[model samples]
Target: MSVTFNDFNLQTDLLEGIKSMGYKQATPIQAQAIPHILESKDLIACAQTGTGKTAAFLVPTLSRIAEGRFDFTSTLILVPTRELAKQIDDQVEGLSYFTGATSIAIYGGNNAQNWDQQKHALTSGADIIVATPGRLIAHMQMGYVKLDQLKYLILDEADKMLDMGFMDDLMKIINQLPKERQTLLFSATMPPKIREFARKILQQPEEISLSISKPAANIDQQIYLVYDQQKLKLLQHILKDVEVQTMILFTSRKSAVNEIVRALQKMGFEADGISSDRTQDERESILQRFRNKQLQVLVATDVMSRGIDVDNISHVLNFDVPQDAEDYVHRIGRTARAGTKGMAITFVNERDQERLVKIEKLIERELPKITLPEAIGESPVYDPAGNRAKFSRDKGGSGGGRGGNRSGGPRREGGSGSGDRNRSSKSRGERPAHVTAGAPATEQAPRVAGAPSTATGEAQKKKKRRKKPFKPKNAEGAGNSTPPAPAPAAE
Candidate 1:
């Protein structure tokens, strides 16, 4: 049975706000979870993205706020990322317009003015606060913020918060909250860890699980077996073949975002890239531009996969296969949202065959593979066992897909010579010397004989340099030390 907002017996003002937002009916999660929340029962609901879970908690909490009219802070919503914090803040603005409830979002950024605004809001006590765990801890560490009268504590995207290693911070904040407050824990999945965590905080919580590990049925999913060298061409082909109005292309590597965006721009597509490397203001600007249809292609790392909420995305392209199978779902979930049928295209290189298999298993269906165009040549055979072994043996040799190249975020782990991900191969523009010119088009095997001995050569060079016996032109000059250059911002 379908449930609409009119049946909830919400306060008239809150109902007006909902109508203004054009939300007449409640989603499944909303229908199941809102009643328990209205009764002040603790809740741990599992609903995937694009399922209106945010409003499920928000509507009831706002109704309580309207009914009680507490003077001090009444609600605190903790999220995993600054983007999500900002998103919830925006939603609260629209939903609370008629009710006159005040809220603010707090997140860490480089801007001094942002910090001041957050500090003021904390001291002044907004009725509701959307905050990231780390930034809220920073404010709570100072003595100005008061949550002793808080009536509701909501953890949005709770699983992602734990995955980002915020358990300690979460516990720290929870210990400071009132014991009698309502606690709502919302997540996209209900793994055992989440169940255990809920047992510690939630009190006989009502549970609702919907569409776990699943993308929408409207999505037209397709996979391409492509080699590293042929991915750029494949993407180009897809862009030319399809009519792409608005698309978000997800990559596993932050380092590769710029490269992919540049390639797309050079091919005459209006494209831009966003990552955590960008400042908070810059990331928001890019997202706004994409939402406004000013940008056709938005390239990003997985950081954008969860926090982004645009509904008109026509397609999603995975530049590189994700490290975790769950990420594949989130990435593609960006499309087929808001009742719109959409498309998802993934380029699976030889080294990522195992990852592709895991994605298939998680989704419980074999993704149809599109044949490679003749001009691009044959792709590596989909032989996960044989290719993984070749990659393992190549770790000891010299070539692309060799070992010891990983040094980045978690998504960079376990990726080996992924198409366009092998920055070494892409930069050098040539295979290693041991690799033959006419190697098999189906496999760029890391079959080199020996690894490069840069360590021994670097040791001899350092030995020769030897600090030059500490000789100095003058004793007075030696006492002065030069300051080092400022390092670049890390991703």
Candidate 2:
């Protein structure tokens, strides 16, 4: 007894828009949610990314708005990120093309002109307003934005908003909304916090759970256990070996995003980093290029995990394991979308072993371990205890060609020492025909732009180990010079 969009009894305009968008069949979330949403009932839906949750709410919301509710801002959709706000606004525009329902997207990270435009939209009362929690709150605080006639309050990616520490802001925004509004809370994972938040906001909501907290089954998952220093080389090798059409690489840190993107670009891969550091315009441009397949790879933090909905993504790379298992699901869910077979590759270092274990537990299956190409270098042995075998730094240039360092130790190209030492940006060209394990130690490679500026303390400590001072027994007989207690042990 499967259902289609035609079964939902949506307004003619919305149905036409859905057809034009080529949405024939309803996703499980969409089918279950649309009926409840059209009934003006509160809903709490637990669905994964790529599950068509956005359209599930938008279609019905738009239909209700199209019923001559254009006099005031009737529907207020709160999302977690600026990117998501824009994404929803785009969908709203397409879905309401026939209905002529008006809407505006309000988000931060732009200048006064953007703010003024948003203020105008908010005060003038569009049919709908798609906004991030923070930005909407900012407008609410100013007392110009009005939602008195609001009939619907939708929280898309509610879990993500809470994760970003917007609980208080959400409360503020919710308190300002009319108490009689229809509330909908959609999330990927429903932990205690989400249940609590839903109870506070949603009124006896009908619940829907579709593949909750699980990634798409079509995604082929693989893991590579490598040392942190070797990740770049291994990534390069993988890109060369695999036919990656367009990929999103997720790292845990903003700095890592910049570093990985710079390194990849130096290697001649079309790559760019997107983070909070980038201006809104820059991020939009980067996203546009990525969507057009002009940018081959995008290195980003978890910010892009939930916001991006690009199709035909060939691969998703977890450059660093995410702290939360739910985040792991979202990161990988970027690929293998809409029944497309995509690949997810994770780079797991020794420290990320526990996080990796958590992800496996959440997904309820162990990802297959990938064998690194010989040219990339020797992969680290998997240690369940998270203890890595200690290897001395190779005096030679960062292990050239990934066969590993001259002494079989970790190698850095410019020099193996510390300080946000930038790896030399100078192209290493193609890997040597025959990598010499006995290559002579070379001078430190010059730092490339965006390379780590702080030297890791461990490397510096290894350089200055003082030999045990021999206490002179005949200090009274010979010119006895006290060793001054070994220089009082350097701090």
Candidate 3:
């Protein structure tokens, strides 16, 4: 089943670059799509992340362009995210290094002056232009980019572009390209909308579908049902285990990414966050550090899940559950790359129950749940207004009051102290106790005027302790033991 690049009749220069990278045989997607693309036929490829999709298209497209048969903006590759655009640009550049084919990547968040210089370079015209749909449209409208000579079009992460509300922009860019050009649409998941979009754009395209429902067979999926408060503790425990080396932690929101990064750092993990808020340069630096193995963990939103092709990621952690099922696939897909085995762990809270069910349906298999630490209780409920009444229901008509009487006549302080023990105990753990019908009593400290609550304070302290460098017991014992006598030298 092994097929070499030479077997595909690729240009000598491109093959040289491929060999220089120490790759010989084509991956499944590369094996299937390269031949079709080499034939100058339109294609719709359904390949998941980490399946060598980049090479599948880049190799064939570069070979076609190097034939010197096309003119005008000969090839255009559009991606949903700026990160992905940069990734595609890098891949094409690397593969075309030996060839004289020129390529440029333009995306949002860059200064117009820089783009102006790049656009001028493209005036003689680029062999290929990898871009984000928004930036590409802007360039096309401003007359900086020309597609009349465009012979090939690529839409990568088509589902993601649609999710980001880029259907209009993608359609606009496609409309501007030549009608006689070849089109390739690659997506991890194909929804009805993506199929409809493909129907409108592609003309009799050949189809290549890989595993679209399940995670890579090489990846081990596990879920941990933990209370929201203890999730961070569990993450710290898992990170401390020797098996985990490098990881990409996915959060649902930009804000959550920031918080997770800070919390993880406080716990002594070399972690960082990347989101739309970061500057392009900063984002690139983070990715570079991650690739160099200088960073142990990268906390990111779903934006970094796709198009990031780091090879040594040992694990993927879902700190915040993904809202979209497709994103769940992509998040875990960061690991188990290139036929390597990896692990993905998700923290499922009570609030995430419904979404987790939906994700299971999408992937068409139930994710096995991991046994959580006994300290971690049932998943904590999330309330925007800090009101527990919506989640709590009383069994008896005690009518103590809806939402539990907050005015339970000021709780008595345990310690024997004068001068208003209520105020003094308030400094201690004197928060309102959550009393359910027959459940064991648990006391939680009330919110202080200016200090963090007792629970938050305890969690923070534990996090700090976890981050400290761990010294092995053997090493400690050896240091305390007496030195042995030297042995006689051998003859």
Top candidate, metric lDDT: 1
Candidate 3: clashing pairs of residues: 267-467, 431-445, 431-446
Number of clashes in model 3?
3
lDDT computed for candidate 3: 0.69
Worst 10 residues of 3 by lDDT: 423-432
**lDDT tens digits by residue: candidate 3, 385-420:** 332233233313342321221222211122121112
Off by over 4 Å in 2: 213-218, 337-340, 371-381, 384-491
Per-residue alpha-carbon lDDT of candidate 1 for residues 1-491, written as tens digits (9 for 90 to 100): 78999999798999999999999889889999999999999999888877799999999999999998889999999987777888999999999999999999987654556767888888987999998776676567557889999889999988777765567778889999999989999998777888999999888888888865588899999999987668777888878888888999987666678878888899888899887667778889999999999999999776556678887889999877875677789778878776889999999877788888989999999999899999888977888888788777775575554232222223341134443322211111111112223321111112123312222344455555654336466866675656444332211
Query: Which of the predicted structures, 2 or 3, would earn the higher lDDT when compared with the native?
Result: 2
lDDT of 2 by residue, 360-407 (tens): 887899888887778777877676553422221321434332222222
Ordering by TM-score: 1, 2, 3
The candidate with the higher TM-score, 2 or 3, is: 2
Query: TM-score of predicted model 3?
Result: 0.73
Which is the winner by TM-score between candidate 1 and candidate 2? 1
lDDT computed for candidate 1? 0.76
